[model samples]
Each structure stands twice: as C-alpha cells, then as structure tokens.
Target: MATSIESHVVDITTCAICLEKLNIPKYLPCLHTFCESCLRTYITAIFEKEHKQSIECPVCRTTVTISKEVNTPDEWAKVLPLNFLIVGLLEKEKLRDHKTMHGEELKLFCADHHTPCCSMCVSIHHRRCAKVLSIEDAAMEYAKSDEVKYLKTHLANVDYDVKVIIKDRSSAKENIDKDYKRKQRDLEVIFSDLVAKINDLKVRREAELLKIYNEVKETIDTTLIFFQNKQKNIENEKQIIDAAVNMASNVQVMIEVEKLKKQVEEHKQVIQSKTKEIVNYELLLQDVENITKLAEQMEKACQISCKKPNTYIALSSVTVTPNVSEIFSCCRFGQHTCSWGVKGAKQDAICVSLSKEIELYGLLSYVCKDALATCDVTATVKDDTTDLVVVKDTIDSKVAENNTVKIMFPKPVKLLANKKYHVVVVMKGTSWCYAGGDGETVVDSNGVVFTFNNSPLSNNGTNTNAEQIPGFVFKISDEL
Candidate 1:
C-alpha cells in the first residue's frame, strides 16, 4: 500500500535540498518547499560568508528576502511559511502506515464526503450522514458513470488540438525560411543590376575619353613630323650653299644664293601657314554634379517592408513563348508593293483581349522583310471612350530574324483581367517587316489565350483586315 501511494506522490513531498521526504517543510516566496534544517544551514552560510539579507532559491534561483526582525539564521528559516499541502500529504502517509501495522481495513465509504473510511471513522465521523456504501460498490458505480466518459472524450480532443498546433507551427517556420531565401535573391538581383549599369557607364566614358585623346595625339604627331622634315630641308640647303661657295664658280655661287633665298621664303611661308593651323587642344571632362545626389537617392532605394500574417507575394514561373504560326501563315501584310517603315509615324498594330490578369514579359512579331531600322513595339491599354492610354510598355526591337522578331520589355507590364489592349509595332524611313493575323484564336502552353481581332489596326488609314491580321503574340508570365 505504501509503495502504491508513493508511486503517485513521492516527488511532491520530497525536499529539493535534502533529496528526501520533507522534514518540517518550509516554503519560500517561489513556492519551492524545503526542510527547515536544510534551509537554516543554507541561509546561515549565505549570511555569514556573503553578509546578505537575501538568498536565492536552490531550484529556481529566485531571490528570497529575510525580514529585518528575524535577526538570527534559525529565526530566518523559521519565519518562512509552512507548506500545508505537503504537511497534509505527510500526515496521510502516517495514517496509512498506522492502518497497515494494525491491520485496519477501510472497506466503507462516505458518499457525502467522498472518501474511504474505516469502521471506527464511520461510527465516529459519519454517524449522522446518510448515503454510505461499501467501497467496492462505490468504485463500480463510478466506473460506469457519465463523468468517466466525458473525461476520456475531453482528453482526446485536447490531444488532437495539441498535435494540430504543433504541425501548424512547423509549417509556419518552413514558410519563413523559404521567404527569407527568396527575398535574399531579390535583393542580390537589384544590387547586381545597379552595379552592372554603373560599370557600363564607366566603360563608355573611358572609351570616349580615350578616343578623343588618341585623335588629338595623332594630329600633334603629324604636325611634329612635318616640322622635322622642313628643318632637314633647310639644313640640306645650308650644306649646298657652303659647298657652292667653297668649290663652284662665282656665277654658280650667286645662282645658288638666289635659289636658296627663294626656297627660304617658301619654307617661311609654309611655317607661317602651319602655325595658324596649330590649335590648343585641351581635353575637358564634364563633371557629374548629380552623382552625390544620385548616391543619396540610391541609399533610400530599397526599404524593408514587413507584412502581416497570411500576406504573400507570388513569383513568376518560366514559360515557353506561345505558338502563333497559324495566325501569321495565311497572308502577308507588308510583302512587295506595300512596306511598313519601322520608325514611320504610321504603325501596324494588333488589338488583343485578355481573359485574366497577366504579367507581359515580351512580344513576338513576324518579320517578312529584314528590319531596316530598330522598331519600337508598344503595348498600351486605352479607355474605351476617351482612347487615353492607361498603362503602356514600349520596347526596342532586340532580336530580329527574317522569320520572326522578339522585342522584350525591360520590365514586365502588369495588365488587368478582362481588358482590351493594343500592341503596336511602329517603323518609318525604310520598310522591312511583314506580319499577318485574324486566322485563329490560339492558346499557349501556359493556358493564356490570345484572341485575335477581326482586323489589323493601323494609323495609315488602310483597310487590310479582310486580307490579313497583325501577326503578334503576347508573352505572358504566371505571376502578377
């Protein structure tokens, strides 16, 4: 019986300091109970060595204050409050031991008090109370009661709730890690783009400076070579005059002197003309006054934005370009007699209606004649009544083949769902590209539908819709 009772409650009555059953259990402010003698020894050592009026709990390390009135260590330990629960448990243990030694069976139970009682306790304590039953009958009734069923059900619900909370927390942690990596990648891309632009600017400026310097240096070098040649000619003339005076006849010397005089006048005139052409070429660097201001602006470019829970930003998925071979295969817009200039004020355009919100990455246009000038393909949303542009993206033609050309926007354009937008490819001075449309409505591999307009749109006032539609397909990404 003692072993069975101890199995349920031995730790509760044990003292933390002595590691045994509590003796005169005293509790500190932190609710940790300890033996009185153990506390006295611990508190006395603290007061003597450290000369402090407070001690930390052995278990939880909470400070416990000693009252000023309690002068001695023994008094300090004695002044702590007693743990009534521990004392009651100890008393119950003593009672159980007495019952076992004397062989007194507590076979009766008082239902009103809800406790097992010996025969003597029933006659003395529960004599006036009714509703007393044998302990075995009471136990059997409790086992079949609704209270037991409710307890089991409640415990099962609590277990399920605990499991769900743990799983949710784990999932939240994983999402946090993924978001961290994605945001880090975004930050790197932004900085890398800035660095690339700065480096490109630096290279271009350096090349310009070097080109100017080389041109000026070459001009100066040529001028120096011309002066050296004139000096050599004069020296040769002087040597000829010296030889004529020393070895030639008087007539020959006079003729040599006249020729030398004429040559000297010609050389002087050439030198004067060359001096007028000599320029003071000094290289000047136009300083960037806004560089410091740009640096200051760049410092505030990226900001850390924290969003609330359940807020998410989606990323675009890579997708293949749509196939529009059927749309452009039937007829040609600019084939032989008619040509659409790339930079011309007149434009060839295709109007498309989108089914859902999409991010436009690029546009694909068919090319019949080779591109003469760089083309600007623009996508614009207009108000139906006013024809004012809402959103627009214009990108220069980057890659143009004889078959088809791809013009990509520097940044993706976000178009709303269920809206009609026009993509216009403009050209001017020389005509090169040919495209056809109005064949069929085609769906891309990414499930984006491209509904072709019945007629091609043009500012040139030409009605060529019945023959062909503008051949173009929008490059849509999955993310907004």
Candidate 2:
C-alpha cells in the first residue's frame, strides 16, 4: 500500500511532456497535463508550421481550441482558471518529499537567528549564534514572555477596534445618505413653489402681451379678405367681356360694347372705405417696459422678511382722522450752540406756538457742544393755559446717528389747535438738551414765537419777549 501511494503521488504531480515535476502545470481538453513552458514551445512550433491556434495533447493527441485573442502562452495561461486541486496535490507531494529527505521536523530552534535549524543547519550556519535551544523548549519559553503576552493582548484589542471602525464607517455612509436626501427634499419644496409662482406670472404677462397682437392680426386679415373679394369680382367681369366679344355677332357686339363701357364706368365709382384700426407700437413698448420694471421691483421686494415692522402700510389720505400732525421738517445743519442746561433737580423751559395744533408722537434734539458720548434726558410738553402736562418722553441715549437724537413719545398727545405750549426738558446726565432752536425755529404766519431760559418759565413770553431757542430739531407728520 505504501509503495502504491508513493507511485500515485509521483504520477499525479509529474508533467507528461517534461517527464519532470510540473512547474506552472497546464491542462488539455483530454484531461492530460503538461508543464506550461514545454507545452508553449510545442504550440509555438505548431503555429509556425500550420499557422493555426490550437493546443494538442501530447498523451491523447486531443485538440483543444486556444483563444484567438491570446497572442502568447503566458497570456493564454492567465485566461484559464488555475487548477487549485492539482496545486494542492503538488504541495503535499513536495512536503512528503522534504520529510523523506530531511526528517519530519527540526529538533532545535536558533533563537538569535529566529528560525528552525536542523543539526546540520546549526553546524553549517548557526554556529556563531549565541542562543540555540530544543524546538519544543523554545516554543514554550517564548509563549510565556511578556512581549508575547503584550502582542496577544494588543492583537485582540486591534481586532475589536477594527470591528468598531467598520461599524462606524457604515454608520457614516448611512448618515451621509440620510442628510443628502433630506437636503434634496428641502430644495425641492422651495424651488418647486418658486417655479409654480413664476409659471403663473408668465401666463398673465404673456396674455397681456398677446392681446394687442391678436387684435391687429384680426384687423389685417379682415382687410385682406375684403380686397381679395373685390379683385375676384373685377376678374370675373373681365372674363365675361372676353366671352361676349368672342361669341357675339357684330350687331350684338355693338350693343354689348356700350353696356360694358357703362359697367366699367360704374365699377370706377369709389367704394366706401372703413377706417383701419392701427395699434401704437410705442404704447405697446411702454406696457412692456412697465411690466419689466414691476418684475425687477418685485424680485427684490419679495424677500423672506423677518419678524419685524419692516412691513409697511400705504394708507390713503382719507384714513387719517382730522388731527394736527407734523408736515415738514427742514433740517438745519445749524451751529451747535444755544443750549439750556438743567442739571440735577433743576429744569429749563422753552415755549413754541403753532398756528395749527399738532399731534406730537416724537421729538428730535442735538447735543450742546460735547457731553458724555451718551446722555439720558426727559422732556415734558405742557398746555400754557391749562398748566397740565400734555405729553412726556424719556430719552435714553443709544447709538446716535449723525449727531441727532430722537425719542418717540410713549403716548402721543394731540395739542389744542392754534395754541401755544411750554416745553420743559430736564437733563438727567451732566448735559444740556435744547427744546427749541434759534433761527431754525419754524412758526406759521400767526407770529408764533419761541422762548428759552435756564430756569423753567411760565407761558406768555416768560414775562417778556421770547428768544429763538436753539438745538431743538422738531419732526412732524401733518401738512404745513
């Protein structure tokens, strides 16, 4: 049985053509095998002689068709699947042959050289190495070393970490897909709605553009049809005259000639004409330009507005109840002087009269020379006759723009029409706030003057003539 096994191993592994061990073994159609290089030489010689592409088995002489596309034996071998079972048998035979010649295993291991060494190998190569031990003892000793334990632990940790990395990579891909789909959906909603809006406007604008064009086209068609009918009638009359002249006798011709002449004269009479409706191209162009302007305006106007009063109302004149609101505000880049300083508990008064009563919602002022970068102040408007406070506003200094300060009244006060009022402004910070201006003071034709003093004064020119107050810039809404 052992002899048979040995013969069978040699038979299975040996190449028939080479009569030696198969190096890169190749198979033929008849299940016969040969060495790749030897078979390639035989195929090349056949190709040279017969100029045909085929592999002929050396044992069975069975012809196998080689691929026409393959130009060389190396390329042809690559095209075929490797015979892995034959390869495994060859490997087993090789190990068996090794054991037969050199024994089953090495008995010693050279630690310094880090390789298995037989007795002959040690004598030949490992004689200079410092460490050598029995193979079994070397294996046991290295297995218990600290470095080995550390290597094992680290390998286990790396395996666990690699699994986690794969899972996270998969999760990242899923997250990317999820976000991509979500963003696409949001874009679809916004742009699709915008497309719908644009389409609707397109229909409306196109309809407007086409209305005049259709009307003009219809008119031209009507005019062409009328002239065509008239032309056909004239041609029919000419044809009839030609027939009469050909078929009529001389006496009949004499009678028909006068009748034809009279008919021609009658045909010469002018036909009543209808006035053509002409569309003005200039007017049409104007309409188009207006629509283009509207498009540009709405493009910027229809932005996504935030939650604020950038929203506006275009109120009609009739909606305003009969009240005195400010009309004109001509700003005076006036000198920054003539200030009334009412610091601490002290206050200053300035009186200004209006020919028409005004509904006071807000007031404006300028700094006296320079004060704190920001200042706090309070203003009170009082009825001169009634001595009752009409409106009061506290001005907290904020980012001032262009050196002008404005504060809106918490509650708007409608002053009595054509009546004089005393405005007392108290400075909370160490700064003066003017309630009236010098030449900048604007009064109607009713000789309404202005008065200013350091101390709070009563009405009626402060017991004397009123001075033109300064630094008081007033803003109003009613018509002058």
Best by lDDT: 1
lDDT of 1 by residue, 135-254 (tens): 667655644554333433433333333233234334444444455456555444444545655545545544554565556556555665565545545544555555555655433443
Return the TM-score for candidate 1, rounded to 2 decimals: 0.26
- Give the range where candidate 2 is weakest over 10 consecutive residues by summed lDDT: 309-318
Best by TM-score: 2
Q: Which tens-of-lDDT digit does each residue in 233-306 have in candidate 2?
A: 44444444444445543323333333444444333331211211211121112232233335444333222211
**What is the Å distance of residue 387 in model 2 from its true position?**
77
Q: Per model, how many backbone clashes are there?
A: 11, 9
RMSD of 1: 43.0
Candidate 2 backbone collisions, by pair? 325-478, 326-476, 326-477, 326-478, 327-478, 436-469, 437-469, 437-470, 438-469
C-alpha lDDT of candidate 2 relative to the true structure: 0.47
Q: Stretches of candidate 1 above 4 Å error?
A: 1-344, 367-398, 441-445, 454-457, 461-480
